[model samples]
Target: MNLIPAYPEIFLLIATSAILLIDMFVSDAKRNITYVLSLVALAGAAALSFYSFEAGAVTYTFNNMFVSDPMSHLLKLFTYLGTAITLVYSRQYIVSRGMANGGALGGEFYSLSLFSVLGQMVMISGTSFLSIYLGLELMSLALYALVALRRNDAVSTEAAMKYFILGALSSGFLLYGMSMLYGATGSLDVNAVAKAAVSGTIKPTVLVFGIVFVVAGLAFKLGVVPFHMWVPDVYHGAPTPVTLLLGAAPKLATFAICVRLLVEGLLPLAIDWQQMLTVLAVLSLIIGNVTAIAQSNLKRMLAYSTISHMGFVLLGLLSGVVGQSSNGAVGAYGSALFYSITYVLTTLGSFGVIILLSRSGFEADKLEDLKGLNQRSPWYAFVMLMLMFSLAGVPPMVGFYAKLTVLQAVLNAGQVWLAILAVMASLVGGFYYLRVVKLMYFDAPVDNSPIVASGDLRFTLTLNGIAMLALGIVPGGLMAACETAIGQSIGHALKNLASIAA
Candidate 1:
């Protein structure tokens, strides 16, 4: 009955409400108070999550609907950090775009983002079907509104509608799948579902059907191929700040639910889901990388790049359960986790630079917008160069290590062909990423306007871009953390399975 497991989420919920109320009373000139308070709330939540990690082993609360463990704590901490960084980077951009003009729309942007973070925390800790669904819906609903925050823009409105419709459809698929699983296993608890899956008492055909729908729904959230129809349009249409929010931190929550659903709840069905993920992984890699080469818009290109990167994550996940033995599970899942974290880090800086370059009435979203970036500001251009290199998986950047680890894990799982295909796809994807670097370093200036960013934005982006190289050079700590988290979680799940059997 200890409440420690839910403390961070509880604190975030309260903080979000307080921020919303306080924001309502603040004047337009004092909106910075809301911004600063929101950042403090996120930092506080992160501190709580880190402190809760001292509990060590996995602990369940609310009748086992929510579980807290090292993995959840670490992911939650990063989610807080990611969201905070997004807010900081977006502050000037939001102001310049009139998104923070002391209105309902302005206030909702911050409040909804905090609520979305609350949902992400819930998703990270959720251990039951209902808990996970509630988190997913909360996050999705907030994002839908945020996408359309620019109420006067027709494109923004259209993108929001498309996202809402597709998002609702995906939710229906996920709920139906959950219902099927509940019917087949007679339990909504993830551990109970796993036990039932392993007992050979349920109908395998029905279980596989549910798994397909669940995977499809999860794939849509992750923006993989065949279900990624909303990504480019939304990224293109939303305000840059909103697009940044969409592109970065939510992926952690999505990955969290994927692990909860596929690994914790349905490990016994690994053979089936792994095969399905193989198709998804392959198609995402091929299409994401190939199509990105043709995109002139920076956001659209990054959208495709995100798809390809997620494909690599699937490769890591699918490789974990190769032949029934969970020996490779730690490495496989750890690689995916590491990849996800590094990707978010890189994305924040990438979009931060975009926001910095953008000003009133200018989007700075086109490829040509980056031309002669070096001539305007060599330091920021260097930052952009590192980000592009990292995204392209060039050597000595964190992205390279991230890709290498996943490929190594796939190879360790005897997925040599999959590994090879991943390498080829990365090579293809590198072209578009390097094109950005070339634009910044080689091409002449298009606007010749001196790049201006707030001191906070500059500081955050500089550190973020540099961290890519720093982590790449010394990736052991983060890699070890990922491995430890995954290993402990897997060990805990196995222990629960043993207890259930006894």
Candidate 2:
């Protein structure tokens, strides 16, 4: 099998091992070396991904178990960036918490993060059930370790146990579904499964059942209603940087798997899965929004908020491929992709502010922790204001555009009622986000000390905030890029499938 398409993953694997080895040897005083090396690794991987994308070719390797296309390339690059930013934002927070180096949980945070990213990359490029499951395990295992990093914290240990048990259940669901599909199709390759599905030899009852289990598994990973028991508790209990790691890039990888399994491997079952998604989406929107109003912790609030936002992503996803209209389906799926990326961007920035506000011996997790943030540091407060507004889907913010595009896709699918429901849920969700803004600007300072941060943290956060506004004002570039990427990747897969059938 040609390994050229996997250069990035291979490089990252080597670098992660090296960093882990180096971190073990370096003195605590020189721990910064590990951080720098981790960033350098991510940069190298990102550069490799960029060059792969620039080659303007779709490639499959390892017996076609892994494929590199525009979508994988784009998502992998963002995964690298998101992980790098998480490292930057968490550097101080983890260091302060003694989770960075020479501390209780220090030895593995950065290394684990890199492994998680590596798994995400594998998931993104995965073209077979085997490859996807391998990646999922790698990512999930690392996250499990990270969650329980603070061995002293009972809450953290509890959260890790819950996450691990629930995560294993989800993986079992996925595997069961995949097994059923393989039995029906006699292959694990996604395209081959699609071919078998279309040839009409597979049992209809078996196909539907397989899809049901698969959708169930995807819903859990996405942390939607019904299967989202772990999101809030885990988000609240984990260290903030670990929380960031959990909350961000992994979603993109999950979204990719959804597309791969549902859209690519099981297109014939779209009507069935789409209806299932509709139910999950509506429940997530209503429950996630309403429950978040009762939360006092900022991380838990974002956790429920995450549930609702995922519903919006599902709206875009379920809206695709009505009656085989390729162009319209591309727009619908692209909208979902766009929503996923922007949501991750906003998540990273929001968590960055939390990490920034925190100091040693203090955790800024409570809603009250943000009281009068404007008085302490107006710039970060403003940065935070933008992030909150974006999450709330306010005007001239990237989030509004993300929501609009998804709603547009929903409407295009003749699902006006679903679109209306999403809008209502968004309005309800806006309350908690606005409460955050109110807490920052209207309340008295809880602590008046200035927000001290590393130069990289301050500079990166500024650019991130600006990006929220700039991308909103000029969303065409990013939107077009997403659309093009989806079109090239999915369309190429379709063409290849047609030719194979011929």
| lDDT tens per residue, model 2, 313-432 | 999989886654444778999999999999999999999998888898888889999999998899999999999999999999999999999999999998999999999999999999
Task: List runs of model 2 lying over 4 Å from the truth.
Answer: 104-107, 492-502
Model 2: clashing residue pairs? Answer: none
Model 1 Cα lDDT, one tens digit per residue, 1-502: 8897898898889999999999878778777888888988998888888887755678889999999899999999889989999999888877778865633226778899999998888888899999999999999999999998888999999999999999999999899999999999999999889989888888899999999999999999999989999999999999888888888889999999999999999887888999999999999999999999999999999999999999999998998876567778889899999999999999889989889999988989999999999889999999999999999999899999999999999999898999999999999999999999899989988899877789999999999999999999999999999999888776755554445445
Work out candidate 2's RMSD over C-alphas. 1.9
Where does model 1 exceed 4 Å of error? 100-105, 494-502
Q: Could you estimate the TM-score for every candidate?
A: 0.98, 0.97
Per-residue lDDT for 105 in model 1?
29
Clash count for each candidate, listed in order shown:
0, 0
lDDT score at residue 44, model 2, on the 0-100 scale: 96
